[model samples]
Target: MSKYIDKQTELKQAMIALRQERSQIYDELKEQVYHTSEYLRPSSILMRTLKDFNKEPEYKTTVITSVTSIIGGYLSKKFLFGKSSSAIKKILGIGIQVFTAKLIAGKMTHH
Candidate 1:
């Protein structure tokens, strides 16, 4: 009867240690997730730049015109090439130009 009691006490202690270790691991994982989310939040620069662009009158018009031009160019290229690879190149070129223009405008206006 004494040996059985000793074995039960040992098992109880091991279970308690295992539960403590699990709790510690859970807390560590929670902390890591919190820190990671904080790091992923948008930077001040991006927010400020977006705010500045929103205040501009020409920004929206420029964006609209850029989009329209890309679409028009793509249609024209498709009509000209009739689904050839060259048409794809033209569409891609228009897309790249619009993207580059937006990036340049953003940088210029922000700075």
Candidate 2:
């Protein structure tokens, strides 16, 4: 009976750890999906608009042109706003890379 109880306890602990790891992986995947969708959303919209225009050119030129202009404006803002958001993103990416490298170095030194 005592051996059975110990085995049960060990099984419970193993299940708990598995659950925790699964939860962490789920959260990370959700975050990645959200960020990826955000990055792709504008392009998706542009593609849909183009597809619609191709299907119905006669009915869509003016509307498509307007939407295209809007998309162009948005892309322009993304890359060429006065401060240039693209530049900022590049700088931020470099900063993150540097920070990550430093963190890895610190961890290695600690070991």
Q: Model 2: per-residue lDDT, tens digit, 1-111?
A: 999999999999999999999999999999999988976898887897778878986656556444555554444444533353476766665555455545544554455
Regions of model 1 farther than 4 Å from truth: 44-111
lDDT of 1 by residue, 27-48 (tens): 9999999988776667755776
Residue 41 miss distance in model 1 (angstroms): 1.7
lDDT of 1: 0.72
Q: What is the TM-score of each candidate against the true structure?
A: 0.42, 0.38
Q: Name every residue pair that clashes in candidate 2.
A: none
Local distance difference test, each candidate: 0.72, 0.67
Query: For every model in order, what is the number of clashing pairs?
Result: 0, 0
